[model samples]
Each structure stands twice: as C-alpha cells, then as structure tokens.
Target: MKLTEARQQFISNWGAFGTHWGINRTMAQIHALLMISPDALSQDDIMAELNISRGNANMNIRELINWGLVERVIVAGERKEFFSAEKDIWKVVRQIVKERKKRELEPMLQLLDKLENTEGDKKDKHMKAFLDTVGSIKKLSKQADKTLDTMIKAEESWFVGNLLKLFK
Candidate 1:
C-alpha cells in the first residue's frame, strides 16, 4: 500500500517485538519512528506521531537512550532536543545483545556460580543433582556469553557469512 501505512505497520510490529526483548511497547515504537525518520524528532513530534502523552514520550525516549538505540541530537536554531536512532542495524543488534547479556545472562550466571558452591555434602543424591544441574547451566551460559561477545565485536559481513556457513 502507501509508505505511510508500511511505516505504521513496521512501528507497530517493532513495538510488539520490543516486549519480547524486555522493553515496553512505547519505547520500541519511539525507536522505530526514529529509525525510519529522515531526521531527528523532538519529544513533541514523537508524542504527536505516536498519539501518546508528553510524559509517555519523554520516559520511553529516555529509556531508548539508555538502551543505546537512540541518542539526543541538536537541530539548528531549535531549543527542543531532538532524538535519533542508531541507523546502523548491525550496531543496533550488537547493542541490544550487549545490554541483554549484561542484564539477564550475567546475573543468572552469577547466581549459578553461587549455587554450584552449595555447602551440602556431595554424597547426598539431591545435592549431587543440584550441583550437576547448576554446572550444566553455567557451562551453557558461559558459552552463550562468549558467543554474544564475539557477535558484538564481529563485523557484519563476516558475522553473517559465518552464520550462513553454519546452516549450509
């Protein structure tokens, strides 16, 4: 259909997908809007376009900024701060993966480390089972952490090519 309709659909779908990534819908929509926009947008512009309140727009924009997906930009002769998304899709994915690993995987791995250090006797079957389970999870988490770190550092061409090779 129209470009406007396509943009709207993309923003809506991106907002929905954000929830799966531990972000709120509005934050993702704001990110989507900035991503597709030709230039930076002010908070007012974001609110009007997203049909959200000023507070909602402000908060989500701030959150998106914290996520490293958006940044504050200054427009010539404009007092209102404008925001823009990281237009490079590879950088966006890397930042998202970095943040997620820091927030989720790292903490889980820390807890697993403590768990594997249980004070109970290993002769107990339940204790043995607990340690074994924790050890397995720790192993997988460490592997994932390494993999994500590599992805964050990898160039897009090499990364995508390597992924394609894995499926071949």
Candidate 2:
C-alpha cells in the first residue's frame, strides 16, 4: 500500500481499537496522528489533518495530556501550542496499564470488597453462593492487582526476559 493510505488505515484502526477500550474515536485518531507525525502539531494542524472540529480536537488533546500519553510543546518562534505523543511503545504501554488499573481495576476491586460483605447469614444457600462468587472475584482481582503492580514497576528488559521464560 501507498504510505498515505497505510497511515490512514492505521489511524482508522487505532480509533476503532480505542472505542473498544472506552476512549472516544476522535481522541484515539488524534493520538494516532501524533504518534505518526515527524514533528509536534498545533491544534489547527491536528484539526485540519484529521478533518475534525476545533472543539473536538481541543478536548481530545486535553484528555490525552491528562492520560500522560501526550504533552504540550512550545516552539521557540511560534505562539501556537503544539502537541506530541510519548513515542516509546514501552512507556506508552506502561502508562496505559497504570491508568487502566487505577481507573477500572482499582474501583472494581473496591466494589467487590463491599459486595462480599453484604449483610446475610453465611448458612443461607443464596447468601453463600453470592459470597462465594464475590470472594472468588476479589481473590482474582487481588492477584491481578499485584501482577499489574509488578509489571508497572519492572524494567523492560526484566519484564521481557521473565515473560519469555513463562511462555517457555
């Protein structure tokens, strides 16, 4: 495929993938554009390139900044703010994992903790079933929390080496 065509396909696919992960399509497209661009781009540049409205571009850019996936840049001679993404894939993955754990997993675990303690006699079959399910979920969530914590803290080389060993 031609370079431009390939880039467009990539941006489209990235946007679709983002929607599956609870992110808006435009935000992911903006991220995809920034990821592939050779230099930082202004809001106007982003809107023009992505064919999105100014407000849409602005909101998504701010969201990306909040997620630590992108950053603002000030050109020496330019007054307009420019944006750039964290291009290192490993850092990008780590940031995503950290944010998801805090936003999704942590809250889920907290909810399960509360649910597991619902007021009911343990001898009741209904209550027993509910508690058992919740307990199992909490156990798995705790394990996942610990594993994700280790992954977030691990150096890239160590993580890759250990992961390879596990696969083998």
Candidate 2 per-residue lDDT, tens place, 47-161, comes to 9989999989989999999999999998999999999998888898898889899999999999998898799799999999999999999999999999999999999999999
Q: Which candidate ranks first by lDDT, i.e. highest?
A: 1
Please give the range of 10 consecutive residues that has the lowest summed lDDT in model 1: 58-67
User: Which candidate leads the pack in TM-score?
Assistant: 1
**Candidate 1's residue-wise lDDT over 1-168, tens digit each?**
899999999999999999999899999999999999999999999999999999999899988888889999989999999999988989999999999999999999999998988898999999999999999999999999999999999999999999999999
How well does each candidate superpose onto the true structure, as a TM-score?
0.98, 0.95
What candidate 2 gets wrong by more than 4 Å, as runs, is none
Alpha carbon deviation, residue 29, candidate 1 (Å): 0.5
Number of clashes in every candidate structure?
A: 0, 0
How accurate locally is residue 21 in candidate 1, as Cα lDDT from 0 to 100? 90
The TM-score measured for candidate 1 stands at: 0.98
